[model samples]
Target chain A: MTDAPPPAPPGRHDRPLAPAGGAQAVSELPVVTTYPLAFTGQAGEYFRIWIVNTALSIVTLGLYLPWARVRQRQYFYGHTWLDGQNFEYTASPVALLRGYLIVGAFFLAYSVTANFDSTLWIAGLIAVLFFGLYPWLVMKSLRFVAASTTYRGLRFRHHGKAGGAYLAYGLANVAAGLTGGLALPWAWFMQRRYQVQNAAYGNAHATFRGDVGDFYVIGLTGLAVGIGGGVLLALPLIALFFLLGGANFPEAGGETFTPGLVAGLVGAYLALLALYAVAWQYVRAATLRSVLNRVEVGGVVRTGATFSPWRLVWIGVSNALVQALTLGLATPWAAVRRARYVVQGVQVRAIASLDDFAADAAPSESALGEAATELLDINLGF
Target chain B: MTLPAPDPLSLSGVFFDGRTSRDRAATLTVSAGEAQLRVDGGLETRWAVTQLRIDPPVPGVRRVLKFPDGSRFETADDASVTALEARTGRNRALGQVRRLETRWWTALGALALTLALAWGFVAYGIPALARGAAKATPRSVLATFDRETVQFLEDGGYLGSSRLSAARQAQLQTEFRRVTAWAGGGYPYRLLLRDGAPEDAPFQLGANAFALPNGTVVMTDQLVALARSDRELLGVLAHETGHVTHRHGLAGVYQGLGLTLLSVAVTGDLISAGTFAAAVPAALLRNGYSRAAETQADEGAGRYLMGTYGTTRPLRDILARLDREDRNADESSVRGGSRTEDLLQTHPGTAQRLRHLRDIEARGR
Candidate 1:
C-alpha cells in the first residue's frame, strides 16, 4: 500500500498494511491482527471494581471518582485490545477534581435557581447560562484529551464553538421535552448540533446521525421504569387507606371524617407512584441512548450505534436502585452497564489484520495505516 | 532547536491554504529521544493523513489527534504513534486526559442540574404564584369601598354646592365663618370641596364628592339639589366642616382614587385608556390619605364647632338628621349603582358618631 488505506483486498479477506519506509529497527511492529475489544475480564471483576469504586466515590460524595476511575480504566483498557490497538485511558487528577467542583457548583446553582419559585424568567435565564458555557467546556475537554496523547499519530486538539450556537440547539431539545414523544425531533436536533459542532478530528470529520428514537426511547423508558418502580415501591400505601377508612378523623367542627376520603388518598398515592416509575424509565432510556449514540472518529466514517431499550432499561434500573440506596455510589454499575451497552451494537470494519478502528473492541491497527498513508501522501499529494 | 508547542495543542485556526475548507491544520512536535509529531486537523481523510505520514516521518510516539471542525480525537500508543502523541504531552498524557474528562463531565453535570432546577420550579412554585396573581386584579387606579354609605344631618338641610371657580372657594369660606360667627356659633360652617368642579353656585356629583385638600368644600350639584332648608343647609355646611376637620375628605378621596390605583397596580389591572384617560386621572387617583391625616381634619372641624358654639348638641343633632335622610334616600331611590354612595360615612357616621358626639357633649354639658 503506497498510500491511503490499501483498497480492500480483492478477496473478502483483507488486512491493513504495515507502515511504509518499512518498520525500522527502532520499531518492530506487531504482525498479529487485532480484533475489536471484547470483554476479556471476568464480569465479576468488573462488578467488583465498579462496586468498590462507585461505592467509595458515592461515600465520598462523588469526590474522587474520576481519578479512581482513571486508574480503573487504565487497568482495564491497558490489558484489553481490539484490532491491535488498545484502549487508551488517561485523566488529569487536577482537571478531574476541578471539573467535579465546577459541575458541583453548577448543580448547586441550578437547584437554587430552580427553587427560586419564579417561572419563565428564571428558567429562561438559567437555561441560557447553562447552554452558553456548554461549548466552552466541550472545547476545553477536547483540548485536554487532544493534548494528552498520540495514538496512531493522532492527538486531540482544542475546539471551541460560537456563542449561543449550542444554546439554540439545546433550547430545541427543551422544546421537545414538552411533547410526550412528539418533541423527540427537537431533542435530537439539540444533541446532533451540539455533537457535530463540538467534535474534532486529526483524521476525519465527525458528524451526528440525529435519530429521534434516541430521545423518545430515553423519555419513555425513564418514565416507565422510574414511574413503575415508584408505583410498586409505594404499594404499601394501601394499608394506610385501610387504616384511615377503618378509623375516622374528627373535623374542626366536631364531625367525623369520611373513611372514603382515606381510601381516595391511598388511591392517589398509588397513582403518583405509577407516574413516578413511568417518568423514571422514560428519562433513563432516552438519556442513555442519546449518550451512547454520540460518536466521534477520525478515520473512516460510520453513523452510530443502536441498542435494544429493554436491556438498557434493566441495566439502568438495577444500577439506579443501587445508586439510589447508596446515594449514587453505585453509579459505576450504571457506567458499566452503559459502557457495555454502548459497545454492544457498535461495529468497526477495518482490514482483518489491520486494526478495526470503529469497533470498541481490542484490535485496531487502522490508525497506523493512516499515519503511513499520510506520510506517503505528503510525498505525492501535497 | 527550540520546537514549537505540540501539533495537537491548538483545536482551531486557519492555516494550510490548500485544505482550508477541510480545517486541515496540523502541527508537529519532535522530542529529542522520542521523535513524534502531534497532528491536529479538521479531516482525517485518506489523502489528508497520507500526505503527512510519508514525510520521512520521524515515527510518532503517543499522538494527540484532533480535528478543528469535528471534535474528533484519539491517542495512539502504537510505538510510532505513541512516539508522535508523546510530543504533545512530553510524557504528561495522564494530566491532559484527566482534564478533558473532567471538563466533559463538569459540563454534563451543569446541564443536568440546571434542567432539574427549571423543571422543579415550574412544577412547584408556579401554581401558588398564579393564585396570588389572580387575587389582585390590578386593573385601573380608582377608589373602592366595600359598601355604600350615606348620612343626612339633624336640621332638615339642603346639600349646598360651592362655586367651581377659584374665587368661589374664597367666598364660601368667608360666608360660612360670617354666618356661624353671627349666629353665635349657631352654625359653625365650612365647606370641604373638590377641585375642577362646576363653578356655578351649586356643585353636583355624578359619582362622588370632591373635597379638595383645602377647607373650601364643593358638594356635588346632586347633593345641593337634594336638600331644602337653609338651617338644614347650615347643618350640611357644619357636616362638611366635620369632614374637613377629620380630613375625611382626603380619606374619601383616597378611598375613591388612591386605593383604586393601589388595587390596579397590585392586580396588574392598569388603567383602561378607552374608559378613562389614564394619565391625569391616574395622577389624581394615586394620592392616598394617611389615617392621621383624616383624624387631624376631623379634630379641626370638631374644635371649630365646639369652640364656637360651646356645644356639641347641634353637631349631634345634625348628624342624626343626616343619617335618617341618607338612609331614606339610599333606600328609596331607583338611582343607578354609581349614585348609591352620596355618603358621610367616614367622619363618624350618624349613629356611632352622634353617640360619640353626645357623649362628648355630656362630658361638657
Candidate 2:
C-alpha cells in the first residue's frame, strides 16, 4: 500500500555498471534504481475467471472466445506490477473476434479442401500461401501485442521490419533444416535477437547483447542431457520388465501385452517425459536469463532475470502431473504459480527516472495475425 | 462552467497524462455524475463520469480510470471508485461477470457444468457428428483416402507382395466376390492379399484383416495361413466388409479431428504443458471410439454368418482363436485383465465380444 520506493540494496550503488553495447558509464549517471517486478494474481481468483470463461466458451460453442481471451489477458496484465504500477491490456474484444473469425474461416477451408480428392490441391496452395506470408504475419502479430500493451499509459511497440522477420524466421529455419538441425542454436539466436532488439517501450527501443556461442552451448547441452538421461533412466525399467518374465517379444507378429510389460512401458515413458521436461526447462531458463539480462531499453533502463533451471523443471513437471491427475482442473493454479515465479525474477534497473519516456504515434493493428500465430502455437512473449 | 459540487466523494491517486510516463500525486472527486482531478503542482481536469471508462475492479487491485483524452487515473480507494461507478451504470454485465468470478459457489457450479458438458460431448455429440460427416463425404474423397493410405502402407514396407501361390489367390478372390454378392453388393469391393509381417515394419501385423473407407479389404498372408477353414476366412472378410459398409474408417477420421479441435479449444493458452496433458484424454477417447466401431462391425459380421451359413460359429471361432493367439504370445497365463488396461484397449475383451455374438445368434434363431 505504500507508494515509497524500496531502498536500494546494500553495496548496489557502489558497484560499477558493466559496460554494455551503447550503454554509458556509471560515473556519468546521476543515480540508479532497481525495481523488481511482481505478479499479484491469485490462483483462487483466476480459477473463478478460468471456470467462467471455459463454461461460457463451451456453451457458446467457442463464439465467446475473443471475450474470454481478453478477460484472461486483462487479469494477468492488470495484476503484474513494476515500480508500483500495473500493466494494462487495451485490445478490444470485437477486434479479436474479427481476427478469430478470419483465422477460423481459413482453417475450415483448409480442412474441407484437404478431405476432398479434387480439392486437395487447394489445401496445398493454402499451405504454400501461409508459409510465404508467415513472416509478415509474425511481424504484425508482434506489433499487435505490443501496441495493445500499456504501462503507465505509454504503449509498447514492435518496429521490426518484415524483411528482418523473414531473415530471422524464414532464412533461419532453412539454415537449420539444411544443417539437419545442427544449426538450431544459431536459428534460435537469430530469432531471439530479432525479437529483443526490435522491442520498444514507448519511444525507447530495446537492445539485445546476447552471444550466439552461448546459445549453442545451452542448446546442445540440453539436447544431450535430455536424450542421454532418458535412455539411462529407461534402461533399468525395460530391463526390469524382461527380468520379471514379461518379455513378450511378439515373434511372427503375434502382439500381446502383459501387466509387467505395460508397467515397464509406462515407467519408461514417464522417465523420458521427465527428462524432456528437464531439458526444455533448462534451455528456456538459460535462454531467458541470457536474453533478458542483456536487454537495455533507451540505454537507461536495464533488465535482468535470474532463474534456476532445476526450479523451473520442478514447476513444469509437477504442474503437468497435477494437470493430468486432476483432469485439467488445476490448470489455473499451475499457470499462476509459474507466472509468479517467472515474473518476480525480473529486475528493472534504470539510471534515469522511470517517468521520462515519451509515447509514439502507434497505428492500430488488426488481431488477425495475433489469432493466426496463437493458432500455430507461436510463443512471442518475452 | 464550474458548478458547486454536491456530495463530492474524494480519493488520493496518481495521474498519467498518456503522452509520457510521468506520474504525480492527485486528488479525484466524484459528484453529481461528473469527476474532477486535482494534480499537486499541476493542472486541474474534469470530465463527466459517464464519459470516463473505469476498468473492472479486480480484488485487491487499484481502480484505473481512463479519460477521453488518453490520460488515466489509478487509485487504491476501491470503495469510493465503486460508489462513483454505480452512478454511470455502464459495465453492468462486466460487473456481474466479476461477481461471478469472485464467488465460490458460482465457480464451483461452472466447473461442474464444464465437466458435464465435456462428458456429454465426448459421449454422444462427437459420435453423432462423426456419423453425419462420414455419411456426407463424397465417394471420390473416400476413394482418394483409401488409395493414399494403401500406397503409403506399401511404400513404407508395412505391406509387401503376397508370397502365396497364384492358385490360392485366385480361389480366395473368387470366394470373396461371392461373399460380397451375397452381402447385397452395396459397394464395388476389392480384396488384396499382402504379406503384412515385414521384417523392418515398425509394428508387426502377422495375421490381420482391415477394410478401407472405399471398400478395399486387405487380408494378410499370415491370416490366410492361420485360418483352418475357408469359412473362418469368409467370416473375417464379412467383418471387414461391415467396416466398409458402415464407413467406420471415415467416421474414425472425423472423430479424431473433432477431438483434436475440442482439446485445442479447451486448452486455449496452456500451450506448452497443457497440450501434452490433453493427449491422455485424447488417446482414451480414441480407444473408446475404436471399441464402439469394433462392436458394430462384430454385430454385422455375426448377422452375415448366421444368415449365410445358418450359424455365427465361424466368426465366433475365428475371433476366439485370434484372442487366444494374442494371449499365448504373451507367454503368460494372465492377459491384460486390469480394468484400466481394458479401458485403454482398442478392442473389447474377447469374452464380451463372443458373448454378444452368441446373443445375436440366439436372437436370429
Candidate 3:
C-alpha cells in the first residue's frame, strides 16, 4: 500500500491468544496483536504548507494564525497512522480565533502595563490572577485537546479534575523548592502520572504503572553524564587553548582577536553544545520509554516505545546543527524526521479488535484554555 | 443553493458511524444534491449533499467526508471528491489555499515575501514603535525606574561607594553640571560616582559611564582615574547628557521588549523561538538598534563639545583610550572575552565614532 510498512518483528506480534474468540478468553492472555505507529508526512510537502502559512499570516497581520495552526496540526495528525487508520484533528478555527483574540488582548495589556513603572502593580495583579487560574486552564486545555483529537472515529477524553491538577502542580513545586531542586525528578514523575492516568481512549481510561524510582534514576544518570561528558570534552579543549598560545597572547593593551583564542572559544562552545544535547536527549528518551512501556489503556491495550538513548541523542544534536546551519529553512525536514523516528518507536498491543472501542459523549470545551496555555508555553502533553 | 443535476459518482471507501470504531465497506453515490451510502450488508444512509462537511485537501492524504450526526466516510479517491466538491461549490477559499500550498512557485514567492516583510519590520517598524512608546512614557515612571535600578545594583553588590577624594568628586560633579547646562539642560540631570569593580558581581563595569532613564548618570571610579584631564571628563559627561536628553535608556528598553514580542510572534511557536536558530537574528537586530542609538548620542555629544570647546578632540581621545582599555582587558582574560564583538557590538566602533566627530568638527568650522 503506502510505502512498504516496516516489517513487524516476528515474536512481538506472533503471540496469538487462545484461538477462542470470546471476550473472556481474549482478556485472559491479553496480548493479541501489535500495531506499529507510522508517520507518512513528507518534508517537501510540509515545507510548502509552512511557507504558505507564514506568508498568509504576515499578509493578514496574524489574523490567520488560528487557521494556520489548525491546518498544521491536521496535517500532522492526519498522517499519523496506527492499524491502517489515521488520527484526526477537528478543532474549529473560528472557535480558536475567539480564544486567540482574548489571549492577544490580555498579552498586549500585560506587556504594555509591565513596561511602565506606574502601571507595574496592575501587571503584577494580572500575573497573580493568571497564576491562580493556571491549574484550571491546564485542566481545560487537556479536556479541549482530548475532545478535539479523534482516532478510528472515537475521540480521546481527559478526565483530570481542576483540584487534582492544582494539588499535583502545587505540591510538586513546593517539594522541588524545599529540596533545592533535588526533588525535580519526583515533580516530573507526579506530573507525568497526572497527565497519563487522566487520559482515555474512548471508554478505556489509561493507567500508568511507571515507578517514581525510574524517574530519579534517569534524572541522576542524565546529570552525571552531562557533567562527566562536559569535563571530558573540556579537557582537550583546555589543552588546545594552551597549546595554541592563548595564554601567551598579550596580557594588556593589545589586540584581542588571536587565531588561537578564536579556535579555543569555538571548540569550547561546540563541546558544551554537544554535552547539552546528549544529556537532554538521554533524559527524554529514557523518560519516554519508561512511561510508554508502563501505560495501559482500558486494560486491553498496552503501549510501548523503543528508543536507544544514544541514537536519539545523535538525532537531536544533528537536527539542531542542521537547523542552525540552514538558518531555520530546514525546519520542516527536521520536524518530519523527528516525528517519523518517534512514531516508529511506538507500538500498541491490543487484546481486542480496534472496532470495539466506543465513543464518549464529546465534552464542549472553550478554546481559551488551549490558547492561554500555548501562549504561556506550558506543556500539558499526555 | 441550487446545482445542476450531475452524473452520480460512485466511490468505494470505509465508513464509520461515529458511535464506535466499527468500519463498514461502503459505496458512496452523490447525485441530485443528495449523498447516499450503502454498506455491503445492505444498510443505507442518506444526507443532503449540501450538508456534508468535507475536510480541505491535503496532498497524498485521504479525503474525509463528515456527515451530519458525526458519521464520516473516508476515501483515498481525491479526484472523485474534487469533482464532487466542484459540483457542490463548498470550501472554495480553502481549496484555493490548498492549491497555493501545492505549487512550487507560489511557495518560493511566499518565502521571498516573508523575508522582505520580516526585514522591513525589523529594520524600520519596531524602532518607530519603540520611539513612540518611549516618548509616551511618563517622566515620573522613568524616575521610579531609575531609582529601582540603582537600588538593584547596590543590593546586588555591583555598585559601591566611590574611592575618589571628596575634592575630586566635587570637582567632577561641578563639571557634570556645567556640561549639562552647556547642552541646554533639557533633563533633571544628576551624577552618581560608584565603584564598579566587585569581583563577586555578575558584570564588571570597568571605566564605564551609563545614563539611566530619569536623567541619572552613573560614572565609575575607574573611568575617573582613566580621564587625563577635567575637560576629558566633561566631554564624557556631555555624552551621557545626550543619552539622558534623548531618552535613549527608555527607548532601548522598549525596543528590547518589541524585539522579544516580534521574535515570539514570527517564529509562531515558543519552542522554535527559544532555539538558538531564532536567537541569533534577534541578537543581530538588537545590536543594530543599539549601535544606531550610540551613533545618535555620539553626534549629539560632538555638537555640544564643538560649541563649548570648539573641538571634539577631548571626547574622541577619551573614547579611543576606553576602547584600548577594553581590548587590553579582553586580551588578558583567557576566556576570549567579548567574542561576539564583531557581530553583536551594541556600540559603533571607536574609530567610526571618532571619524563622525571629526566630520562634525569640520562642519562647525
1 or 3: which has the higher lDDT? 3
Q: Which stretches of candidate 2 lie over 4 Å from their true place?
A: A1-29, A108-120, A180-183, A220-266, B1-12, B57-60, B79-86, B150-186, B190-206, B220-234, B269-280, B306-310, B326-338
Give a tens-digit lDDT track for model 2, residues A271-379: 7777887898788877887788889999999998876766876898899889878878899999999888888888889888788999988889888889888876776
User: Which candidate, 1 or 3, has the higher TM-score?
Assistant: 3
Candidate 3, residues B188-270, lDDT tens digits: the string is 78899999886687788888899897889999999988877777777888888878777888888888777777777766654
Model 2, chain B: what is the TM-score?
0.85
In model 3, where do residues sit more than 4 Å from their true spots?
Answer: A1-31, A100-134, A180-186, A234-270, B1-4, B7-9, B150-186, B191-207, B218-238, B266-281, B306-310, B325-342
Per-residue lDDT of A1-382 in model 3, one digit per residue for the tens?
1222224311223445466857555345445688888888889888988888878988898889888888888878888888777889988889888988887787778887986567899889888888788778887888889889988788899898988888777678678999997998888798788888999988889999997899999999999998999888878877877776666665735656676687778778867877887887888888888899999999888998886767777777888789778767887888888888888888998878777988887778889989887776776533
Give the TM-score (vs. native) of candidate 1. 0.36
Query: Which docking class does model 2 fall in?
Result: acceptable
Q: After superposition, how far is residue A126 of candidate 2 from its true place, in Å?
A: 3.3
- Report the C-alpha displacement of residue B251, candidate 3, in angstroms: 1.5
Q: In candidate 3, how many Å is residue A109 off?
A: 5.4
Interface RMSD per candidate (angstroms): 20.5, 4.7, 4.0
Per-residue CA lDDT of model 2 for B246-277, tens digit only, reads 88999999998888778777667424424556
What DockQ does each prediction reach against the true complex?
Answer: 0.01, 0.36, 0.37
- What does the lDDT come to for candidate 1? 0.41
Rank ordering of all candidates by DockQ, starting from the highest: 3, 2, 1
